[model samples]
Target chain A: MDIIVSQLMTGLSIASILMLVALGLAVIYGVTGVINLAHGEFVMLGAYAAWALQTEFGMGLLASLVPIFIIMAAVGWLVEVLVISRLYDRLLDTILATWGIGVMAQQAVRLAAGGELRYVQMPEPLSKSVTILGATDSAYRLFILFVALALFAVTWVIYRHTNFGLKLRAITQNRAVASSYGINASRIYRLTFAYGAGLAGLAGALVSPLKSVSPEMGTNYVVDAFMVVVLGGTQSLMGTLASSGILGELSGYLAFYSNDTIAKALVLLAIVVLIRFRPQGLFTARVRT
Target chain B: MSGKTKTEIVICAAVCLAILLVPVFMNDSFLLNKYARYLVLGMLAIALSLSWGYAGILNLGQATTFGLGSYCMAMALKLKTIPIHTGPDGLPDFMVWNNVPELPWFWKPFYSTTFGVTAGIVIPLLFAALLGWFMFRGRVTGVYAAITTLAAMVVVQLVIIDQQAYTGGFNGITDLAQFDVAGFAFDAYGSASYYLVAICLTASLFLALAVTKSKAGLIVQAIRDQEDRVRFFGYDVALYKIFIFSVSGAIAGLAGMLYTIVMEFASPTFMGVPLSLSVVIWVAVGGRQSLVGAMLGALIVAGMQGALSESETFLDSWTLVMGLLFVLVVLFLPKGIAGAVETITARFERRDPAPAQQPQRTDAAGAGTHHLESLP
Candidate 1:
């Protein structure tokens, strides 16, 4: 009973990370119809940002979150204006182009920061253990679980009631119609893209203490995030949230039963089968062809 | 052949001539060997172009087939070096290290050269056909196909790594002997290896050219450009996709075999996402729709990568340079380096534009990739 409860905690925590990574990707794909391959790099940059803040400037982890979000948001905006904006009409080219950006971002980080893995020191306050259901686990994992929930709630509020969200939804429904109604679709996209990027940064900041920070960290996250976005209908936030939960828990349970590598392979096989059956995604979005 | 096709062939012949003269001009055996290796990679680029550029199927897992081919050859070579092929306890050294008391079941057939050679090519082809059936049968095309291939690649790579006892795990199959065909031995260090690679490259190039320029090739291109229209015309779209995909896999497998011969080892790095992405970029940078362009693109890009990464000063920054180049090429030069070459040559020759630019430039299928998904 204790082991099962612990595994559930692990599954939920992993699910949170998956949802965090996919949040940005789902938003961008939903609004702009651009599958931004560089979404992973944005998360990577956020981790580096936290490392720099903690190591170089002596800022606390929570304190650096806002700055990292702002910096990464600006970077995301620049990417939109310079590269992604031009190739909006070409799906494959955007994929290739964004992939190029992803590579550049990775290399740029490597060249600037050096290739060695950097650690983000966990704050002293949360460095203790907590017990629940007769199981002992680190407080940091519980902290991460809370942060993930907070992020989801924050994202939901932003999408549900804000003017930016309204414009984003209008644009998604019909860009031309939205423009005629005096909503600048371009501005909405730029801001939304940046916002999405900021969410990725936030996720990175939250998860930095748990994993080693490196230039290639984004690549792994991006692959998982892509799977999550696809498995959930790409256009539906609720679907993204649910699918991430399903996959994260599935892998978590499988890993406990077997090994990590076998669990990963089985997950991939499951995803491939899933995509084959429902190419559009888990939930069908109502849209005009 | 048409004049444009003839020009493409002539340019490829010139590249072959340059490679052929390397041993004569440069006494450096290392450089000569590197050039041979690049030629083999160039074959891979052509295979990518055949499926991606010509058939409009972006098979991101092209490297998987190539790596499988390399493993096939490496397994055969590893078996030959052993004193015996049978007995449960007579395992390869690595398996012995892993405490396997017997030879694994899969490693048995590789003891025969014929089986190895045939299996190397056919396995990838069959694999592609099976994958294509799953993908195209479900009407998965474009970005969907790309994602599926990428996922499949990760799965295959993980499996290879996990089964370390049988596959030698991450170290992969190594310490291979010079490749032999029946009784004929091709020495790795000698000129025989170079000639072997050169001949295979030339044969593969011709084979690709023949396929792309044939009547069936035109239909395949048509399918890429106008899938719905072609389907309306009463053709099996999935059949065309599967055929081209399988052919591409065969070529990639052959390239893998040559890679094993030249490099004397096979590793999972060859089948991973990064290398696979580089192959796509090479084809895109070379001019995706042109075979000769794709081959030259791989050769040039790989050659530069080698020189840059090897030099002490640029070693750290070469990957950054490559990424920047990739982005710039994707954005401003969508037609690629080869496209520029083709345009310039066409202008110099001042050929009849009417014949060159036929009226069949169907505007519908020419969207850069896809303008947009349906709006909600």
Candidate 2:
């Protein structure tokens, strides 16, 4: 019972991280109709940025997040303006181009970090454990959970209540119509792309302390996040969050009993089966563009 | 052959001759060997172009099929030294480490080279056929097909990585021997290996071209351009997709077999997602609609990598350049290097017409539109 609860918590924490990763992917896919294969690479870049700041400036974890997010967001915007802009309507080209970008990013990281997995230093507060619901858990896990939830809340609030959010939603449904209504489609695209990438960066920063930081680490999570986005339906943030949580938990529970590789394969197989049945996704929206 | 086709054949022959003479001119065995490996890689890319460039099936799991071929060859090579009943000294190393009593049932048939080769091509083709039938029959196309294949790649890689006892885990099968054909021992190293790879690559290219020029090839292109229309014409789109997919898988397998011969080892890395993605890039860069373009793309990319890896200044940033090139090509040169070349040459020829008038220009424009409409 104790093991099961502990595993469940771990799963929830991992799911939270997965949600953060998939949210950005979902948003970009929703708005631009571009599957950013390099989306995971952005997360990787953010983690590397945080690591660099921590090492060079000796800054605390919290202090590093701001710079990391800003830098990654800037990079994202540059990518949008320079590369992804031309590939907006062409889905297959965007996939191939971003895949190339991903390879380059991963290799660049390898050159900088020497292909060795680096350990991120957790703050003293985050290194300890706490009791929750009659079960002891790592505080770092709880912190990750809180941060993810907070971000989710922030994203929800931004999307529902803000003008930018309304514009984004409108553009996502139909860019041509949105443009006709005097919303600058290109500007929204650039901002949304950067914002989505920034969220991925934030996800990386949140979990850097938990996992070993490596150049190739993004490849591991990207597929799972893709699965989450696809399973949850590409347009809905709520659907992405829910699906990420469920899939992450299922994967974690399976990993507890079986090997990690098998667990991952099972998750992918489940996603394929789900996709075979429901090509429109589980929680589809009526936004036909 | 028409004069144009004859000219093309001559140019292709000259290029093949130049490639064949590289080992003769180069003193370094490594350089020659690298060229040979590139040829095999080129074969894989050609396979990709046939399916993706011509047929519009973006199979992201090309590496999976390639790995199948490599493992097939590796298994056959392993069986020659090891006894059938007593597998590699009473137990294969991995199974021994995992404490398995007997060889798995699947490993038994791999003892025969014939069976191994057949299984290698058949398995991937069957897998692709089944997958393609399920997806294509249900009318999956474009991005959905790409995602499904990508999923298959991830699943296959995970499976290969997890089945450590049979697969050698991350440390893939090694110490493979040279292939023997009907009791004739063939050296699998140095010049001999290069020749073997060349032969396989040429044969595979010929086979691919034959398929591309056949009636089925025309139908495949028709399906690519208009699937619904093809279906309306009473063509079984699913069967054609599955057939082409199987052929592509077989070609990829053949490339894998040659790859093992040239590299002298096979690892999980050979079949990773990156390589699979790289194959797509190769086809795209070469010109998706042209077989020769696919080969050129693979040759150029692999050659660049070899050169860059040997250089001190640009060793790490090669992929960055390739990535930039990818984005640039997609943005500016959608038809790729070959397409760009064809466009330039056509313009030049148009300027120097042989007594042709305005009628030819209209015909040329009509041809161009036909080509454009055929493109996916």
Best by lDDT: 1
Please write out the lDDT profile of model 1 over residues B153-229, one tens digit for every residue: 88999999999988988999876666887678876656677777877888788888888888778889988878887
Clashes per model (N, Cα, C within 3 A) = 1, 0
**TM-score of every candidate relative to the true structure:** 0.94, 0.92
Q: What docking grade applies to model 1?
A: high
- Against the true structure, whose DockQ is highest? 1
Error of 1 at A284 (Å): 3.2
Worst 10 residues of 2 chain A by lDDT: A280-289
Off by over 4 Å in 1: A285-289, B84-90, B347-376
lDDT of 1 by residue, A155-268 (tens): 788888888788888888889999999998888889888888998898888789999999999988988898998888877888888988988899899999999999998988
Stretches of model 2 off by over 4 angstroms after superposition: A111-114, A285-289, B1-11, B20-32, B83-91, B311-313, B354-376
Alpha-carbon deviation at B29 in model 1, angstroms? 2.6
* Fraction of the true interface contacts (Cα pairs closer than 8 Å across chains) found in each model: 0.80, 0.71
Candidate 2 chain B: worst-modelled 10 consecutive residues by lDDT: B83-92
> DockQ scores for all the models shown?
0.82, 0.62
Q: Give one digit per residue, the lDDT tens place, for model 2 in B216-325.
A: 98899999888888999999998898888888888888888878777767788888887888888888888887777888899998888888887765867777788878
